[model samples]
Target: MTIRIGWIGCGRHATWMLMPQLARSGFEIVAVCDRDEAAAHAAARQFGATEVYGDYAEMIASARIDAVGMAVGPEVHYRATLAAIARGLPVFMEKPPGATAAQAEELMRASEAAKVPVTVGFMKRYSTGNRMAKRILDGDAFGPVLGIHGSYMTAPTYFAGEVDYTGFYLHHCVHYMDLIPWFAGAEFADVQLRKSVPGPGRMLLHMNFACENGVIGNVIMGTVQSRGTPMEFVQVMGDQNRVEVENVINLAWHRNPPFKAEDPQATLDPGCDTLVWTPNFTAAANEDHKGYHALLLDVAAALEGRASPAPVIRDGWLAMRRLERMIALIEG
Candidate 1:
C-alpha cells in the first residue's frame, strides 16, 4: 500500500534530496512539477513519476496523489503551500516557513480551516542524533534546562540570488532557529543581536536571548563559512548534565564530572560519563539522516491517521516569528 506523492519544485533540492527519498521510500510518485518543463520531465523520468506539470495549481488540481512535497524557496513558499493545502492533502514544505508573520499565520489558519496536516522542512529535528538527544533531554535525568547554546554557519552562496530573500540567518538558519526552543519545549521571549557586515551578502551575528520558559540561549552565525565546514552544534546544559548535538548527526551527552578539586575527598562522588552517537553509514540508506526518508514516512503516517503530523504548521509559524525577530534586531 504505497502512498502516492505529488511533488512540486523539481529543482536542486527536489532533484538532489527529496526525489531520491520519495523514490526509495516505496511511495508512488504520481506527479512531478516545476516552472521549468524540462526539469519536471527530468524528475518524473528519474523518479518514475507518471505525470509532469509546469504549473503547480494544474498539478494539484489534476494529480491523484495522496500527499504533496513542496521544496520551493522562501519567497514563494506561502503561495505554493497555500495551493497544496487547498488541495486537501497532507503537505511537507521547506522551511523558514513563510517570509512574514502574516504569511506564516495565514498558512496555519488555512491548514486548520481545511483540516489538512502540514509540516515544515526543519529536517534537523528529524535527525537520528537530535532525536536521541531530545529523548534524553526530555527524560528526568536531564531535568530543567539552564541554557542552550546553538551555532549554525553556512555560505550565503546558498541563497546567492532571488528577490527579497533575507540573507543567511532568516533564510537558512530556521532549522536550528526552530530547534533551539524546541529542544527546551519553550517559546522565544527576547533576543539581542550584534551584527557585523563583513561584505556583500555576508554577515556575522552574535546573539543572546531567552525562552519564555526561562531557558537562556546564545547563538553564533557566519555567512562566509567554508564550503565543507560543518560548524553547527546545540549544547544544552541542565541540572548537572549536558547534551550537545554536533553537525546535526553527532551527539555527546555528559553526565557527572569529577571535579579537579584541591580536596581529594570528592573522589568518592566521582562519576564522569560521556556517551556519543554517530550514524553508522556502513549500510545506511536514505533514512539514515532522518531527513528525507524519515520525513516522508512520517507524512505518510500522518495522512493515514497512524500518527499526528510532526513539526506541524504551528511550529513553522513559531519558527518564522523567531527568524523575523532576529532579522528585526539585526537590520534595525
Candidate 2:
C-alpha cells in the first residue's frame, strides 16, 4: 500500500538527503509545507507533491494523507508532531525532537496515548560501518563489550552570534547522546564533562560516562574542526578484541591473532586475523553509506503499519534528556 504523506520542512537537507530517499518507494508525498513559501513550492514541484502550504497545521488538517514526515526546527517538530498524533497519524521527524527533554516527553506520552508511532531520525545507527561493528559485537566470537570511545566533530557553522552554543548542542552534539547509549546497549548511569573554549565560537568537549551495564567510555565532540576532513570515528573494545569504525565508512575488526614474528610460514588466519572493510566507490550502485536511505526504509515500513526497527519518540526523549544533562553540566 502506498502511504500518502504530508511532508514538512523543505530545506536543503530535506530536499537533498531525505526526500530523495523517501521518494524511492511505497510513499507518495501529497502535500508539502515550509514557512518559506518558495521552498515549499519548489519542493512540491521537485517531489511531485500537489499541494504546498506555508503552514504545516493547515496542510495536515486538510491534506488527504496517511502519515507525516518532517526535518524542521525542534520547536516546530514538537508542535507539528502533536498535531499529527492528535489525528492518529504516524510520523517521522528529524532528531532533537523538541527544544527540551520535557517537550520530547510530552510528545512521547501523546503518541502513546493516541496509539501512534512517531519515528525519530537517528541515522547514525544505520551507518554502514557502525552496522557492521554491531553485527560483529553480536556474534559468538566477540566477548562481552568492555568500553566504547567516539569522536564526532564539526565546524562552528551552527553558531550565528555572540558565541552561544545552543545550535551546536542541538544540531551537532545531540547525535552522540543517542549513539553511545545505543552502542553500549544500556542507558547512561553517570556523566562527567570537561570543556575547552579556545576561541569565541570554537568549543571542545570531552564527556566521560558510564553505562548501566558497566561499560565506560569517553566521547569527544566540538565545533572546532574543519568540515572538509573526516569528523567522526567510533571504537568499541572487548576482551582482546576491538572494532573500529572510521569516518562512518571504514571499519576494522581486530581479533586475538597469534604472533608470527619468528615464523616464516605465517598466514592470514580467518579466525584470529584482523578484518577490514572500505566502500568501493567505483561501483555504479547508489549507496548511501551515511544512512538516510536505510533509515527512511524502516520509517516507511512503520508508517505503513508494518513492523520496523526505526528509532521512535522514546529514543528521542532519552537522547534529549541526556543532552540536557550535558548542557547543564557545561553551563555550570
Candidate 3:
C-alpha cells in the first residue's frame, strides 16, 4: 500500500529537500498546506499534490493522508503536531520539536495516548558514519568510551535570519544534544551552557554534559565562524580508538596511539603513518547526502509495521529536557 503523505509548511526547506525525495521514496504527496497560499499552491503545482490548504486543520480534516510531514517553525510545532496526533496521523516533525520542554512532553503524552508514531527529524542519527560509530562503540572496538567532543559551525548564510543567541541552543544544538546520548549509549545526567559576549549576527555556545556511562561531553557551536569553515564535525574518543566525522560527509577512524609523527625521517618506520583511516562517500548524491536515505528507510519500516522510528516521541522528550536545562543555565 502506498503511503499518502501530506505536508504542512511548504517553505524553502520543504521545497529544497523533503519534497523532491517523496515521490521516489514510495510516498504520494496528496496535499500541501502553508499559511502562505502562494507557497502552498506552488508546492502543490510542483509536486502534483491533489489538494492545497492555507490552514493545516482544513487539510488534515479533508485529506486521506496516512502520514504528515511538518516543516513548520519551532513555535508552531506543538500545536501542529498535537492537531495531527488528535486526528490519528503518524507525523514526521522537523527538529527542535518545540520551543519549550513542557510543550515537547505534552506532545509525547498525546502521541502515546493516541497510539500514533511520531518521529523527530534528528536525521544525523541515521547517517552511515553514525551507524558505524554505534557499531564500533557497541563492539568495544573503541574500548571503554572515555569522552566526546563535537563542533557544529556554519557560516552566516546558513543562519537564515537574525537569531537570539540563547535560543539558538534550543533551536539548533538540540540535534547534537540529542545524538550525544545516543552515540554514547547513555543518558545525560546534567548540562551547563555558556554563551559568548553580546554581539550582532554572531553567536557561540559551549555545552558541558555528564553522561550515564560516566563519560563527559563537550560540545561547541558557533554561528560566527569563518565562511569557509566546515558545517559539522564530531569526534568520539574511547579507551582504544577514536572516530571523527567531518563536514557530515567524511568519516575517519583511528585505533590506539592517536597521533602520527609528521616527519618520516624522524619516525622509526620511516614511511610509517600515525592515523590509519578510510573514506567512504557512498550516498553523496541524495538531498543532504549524509543520512537522508537511512531516514527514509526507517520511515518506510515504520510505515510497514516492521520497526519503530528512531528519535521517537520519547527521544524528543529527552532532548527537550536537555534543552530545558541549557535554557535554565542561559536564563540564570
Candidate 4:
C-alpha cells in the first residue's frame, strides 16, 4: 500500500534535501503546502505532487494524505502537529520537533491522546555507518561498555544562510545528538555543559552526560571549524574493544582477542583485527546510501505496522532538552 504524503513546507530544505528524497522514496506525495504560493507550486511540480495549498490547515484537512511530512520552522511545529494529530493523521516531523522541550512535550501528550504515531526525522540515525556501529555495539560483542566520546564539527553550509554553525547546532544538530543515548538503549540521567563559546566558524560546545545505563559520555561539537568537508566521529570503548563510526562513510571496530601474547611477532594476529565497512555507491536506490530516504521508508513501514517507529517524539524531546540546556549555560 502506498502512503500518500502531504508536505507542509516547501522551502529550500524541501527543495534540496526533502523533495529529492521523497521523490525517490516511492511514497506518493499528493500535496505540497507553503505560505509562499510560488514555492508551493514549484515543489508540487518538481515532486509530482498534484495539489498545492497556501494554507497548511486546508492542505491537511482536505489533501486526503495518509501522513503529514512537516518541513516547516520550529516555532509552528507544536500547534501544527497538534492540529494534524487531532484529525487522526500520522505525522513525520522534522527534528528539533519544537524550539523548546516544553512544546515537544505538549505535542507528545496530544499525540498520545489522539493515538497517532509521530516520527521525528533524525536522518543520521539511518546512516549506514551509524547503523552498523549501533548494531555491533548493542550486541555487546566487545563486552561491557567503558565510555563514549563523540564530536561533530564542520561547515554549516546547509543552514548557513539562516544561521551560523553554533546557531545551527542549537537548532538542528539533534540529527546526531539524539543518537548518543539511543545507541545505549538508555535515557540521559544527567548532563552538564562544560564549555560553550563562540568563534569564527567555531560554534564550540563541550558536554558531559550520564546515561541511565551507567555509562558516562562526552560530546564536543562545533561548526566554526572550517568550510572544508564536514567531520563527525562517534566512538564507544568496551571492556577491551572499541567501535568507531567515522563520519558518514566508515564503521571501524578495533578488537582484542583473548590471546595472551602467545607469540612475540604476532604482528598479523587476527584477534586484534581492525574491521572496516563502507557502503558501496549504488544508483539503484536512494535508501541504499543510508540517506534521509531510509528514514522515510522506515516511517512508511512503521505507520503500516511493518516495523517500529524510532527517534520518535520522546527522543526529539530529549535531544531538544539537552541542546537547550547546553545553550542556556552559554547564553545565561
Candidate 5:
C-alpha cells in the first residue's frame, strides 16, 4: 500500500531535502516535473520515478499520482496547488503557501470545495523543540504565557540573489512569524513592521505582533551579519518560567523565582540565587529540520485513516494572513 507521490519542482530543495528520503520512507516518487526538462529528467532518473515532464500539467494528467509535493516558488504555488486540488490530488505545499493573502484564500476555498487534504510546509511546527514547547503549554506546565521574543539573523551572503527572487521576510523570516503564534498558543491580533536599508545588498526588518492570548511578540530579522553565526532564537516566557530555543535546535528552560524579591540586588547574594534553570541540546537525527519524513508519514497516516494532518490548510491560511498584514505594514 505504498503512496505514489508526484513531485513538482525538482530544484535544490527537492533534490537535496526531499527525494532522497522518499525511497527510504516507503513512498514512491512516481513522477517528476520541473520547468527545466534536464533537471526533471535527472531527478526522475536518480529517484527511479516512472515518468518525467517539463510541464506539471502533463505530469498531473498522465501520472498515477495519489499525492503531490509542491516545491515551486511562492509565485507559482497558488496555481500549481489549485490545479492539483482540482484534479483531486492531495498536496503538501512549500512555506509561505502563496505570495499574497488573496491567493492563499483562493487555495483554501478550492481545497474545501474539492474535499481534499492540504498541508503547509511550516516545518518548525513539527520540530522536536516545538513539539516539546507545545506539550508544556498544553499541560500548563509553563503557567499562563506572558510573552515571546524571537530573532532570526542571517549573513548577507546567504541572500546573494534571493532578494531578487522573494522578499526577505517571505523567503526567510516567515518561519519565525508563523511559529511565534504556534509556540505561544495564540493567534496574532495585529502586526507592526519596520525596515531599513543600512547598506548595499542589505536589509533589516523588525516586526512586532500582538497576539490573541494577551501575549506580545517581537521578531527581529537582518541580513547584515557574518557567516556561520547563530541565525535563530525563540524565547517564550510564562507565569512560572521561560524556555529558549537557540539555533532552532537547542532548548533551555529557566524557572521563575519561587519567592517575590523587592530588589534585583537581593539575588546577587551568594546564597540567594532565585532562578532555577536547566539546559539540554540534541541534534535532530533526521536530515530535514522541518521533519519532512514525519510530514509525509502523517500524510500517509491520514490517507490510511489513522491520523489527521498537522499545520493543515487552516494553519497555513492563518500564517499567510499574518504574513500579508506584515508585508502591508512594511510596504506602507
Candidate 6:
C-alpha cells in the first residue's frame, strides 16, 4: 500500500538522506512543509510533492496525506508529531523525539491513546553490519549476550557556535542510548558516568550500565574525533563467542575456534571459526550504508498496518529516559 505522507522538513538531511528513499519504500510525498519557502518548494519539486506549506500545522490540516514524516528540531518534532496524532495520522520522526524525557513520555501516551504508530529514526539498529551481528547473536551458535561495548564519536560541529552540549547529547549520543539496550534486549537498570572536557566544544564520556536482563555494558561517546574518519564501533560478547561491527559496514563474528597452527591438516572450520564480512562498494547497486532506507521500509510497513520492527515512540521514550539519567549523572 502506498502511504501518502506529508513530510515536515526540507533540510539537507531530509532532502538528501531521507526523502529520496521514500518512494522506494512505498511512501508518496503528497505534501512538503518547511519554514523556508524556497526549501519547501525545492523539496516538493525534487520529490514530486504537489502541495507545499511553510507551516506544518497548515500542511497537516489541508494536505491529503495518510501519514506524517519529519526530521526537524526536537521541539518541532514534539509539536508536529502531536499535531499529526490529533489528526489520527501515523508519524515518522528523527531521533531525540522531544527535547526531554517527559515530552517523550507524553508523546508515548498520546500515541497509545490515539492508537497511531510513531516511528523514531534510530537507524543505527538497521545498519548492515549491526543487523548481521544481531542475526548472529540470535542464532543457536551464539549464546545469550553477556555484554556489549560501543564507541561512537563525532567532531565538535554540534558545539561550533557555543559550548552547549545539548545538540551533541540529543543528536549524537542518543543513538547509542537506543542501540546498546536494544543489543542487550533489556532496559537499563543502573548507570554510572565519568566525563572529561578537554577544551571548549570537546567533551568525552564513558558510560557504564547494567541492564534488567543482567547484561552489562560500557559506551564511550564524545565530540572529540574527526568526522572524515570512521566514528563508530560495537562489540557484543557471548559465551566463548563475540561479534564486532566496525564503522557500521564491516563485521566479524568470532566463535570458539581451536588453535590449529600445530596440525598440518589444519583447515578453516565452519563449526568454530572467525567469520568476516564487508560490503562491495564497487558493485553497481544502490545501497544505503547509514540504514536510512531500511528504517523507512519498516516505517512504511507499520503505516500499512503490517507487522514491522520499526523503532516506535516507546523506544524514543526509553532512550530519552536513559539520556536524562546520563545527563543527571554528569551534572550531579
- lDDT to native, each model: 0.79, 0.92, 0.76, 0.76, 0.75, 0.93
RMSD of each: 3.1, 1.0, 3.8, 3.1, 4.7, 0.9
Candidate 4: list runs displaced more than 4 Å. Answer: 23-26, 156-167, 196-202, 257-272, 282-290
Compared with the true structure, model 3 gives a TM-score of: 0.87
Error of 2 at 254 (Å): 0.6
lDDT of 5 at 105: 83
Q: Which model is ahead, 3 or 6, in terms of lDDT?
A: 6
lDDT of 3 by residue, 96-168 (tens): 7887788889989998888888888787887766766677677834577778888886544444566555456
* Candidate 4 lDDT over residue span 254-282, tens digit each: 98754448776666555577887876666
Error of 3 at 255 (Å): 0.8
The residue pairs that clash in candidate 2, if any, are: none
Best by lDDT: 6
**TM-scores of the models, in the given order?**
0.90, 0.98, 0.87, 0.88, 0.85, 0.98
- Model 1 regions lying over 4 Å from their true place: 24-26, 158-167, 259-272, 283-287
Residue-wise lDDT of candidate 5 within 1-332, one digit each (tens)? Answer: 78799999999988987677677665789899999988998998899988888888877777898888778887777778888888888887777788877788888888888778777877777665565665666674567888889888876764564354156666676777678888777888877878887876687888887888799879988888765888877888876577777765566666644354666554433232233222333655445545677666676665444566556667777777877677777667
Lowest lDDT block of 10, candidate 6: 156-165
Residue pairs with backbone overlap in model 3: 260-274
Better of 5 and 6 by lDDT: 6
Report the poorest 10 consecutive residues by lDDT, candidate 5.
270-279
- Cα lDDT of candidate 1 equals 0.79
The true-versus-predicted C-alpha distance at residue 1 of model 1, in Å, is: 3.8
Clashes of each: 0, 0, 1, 2, 0, 0
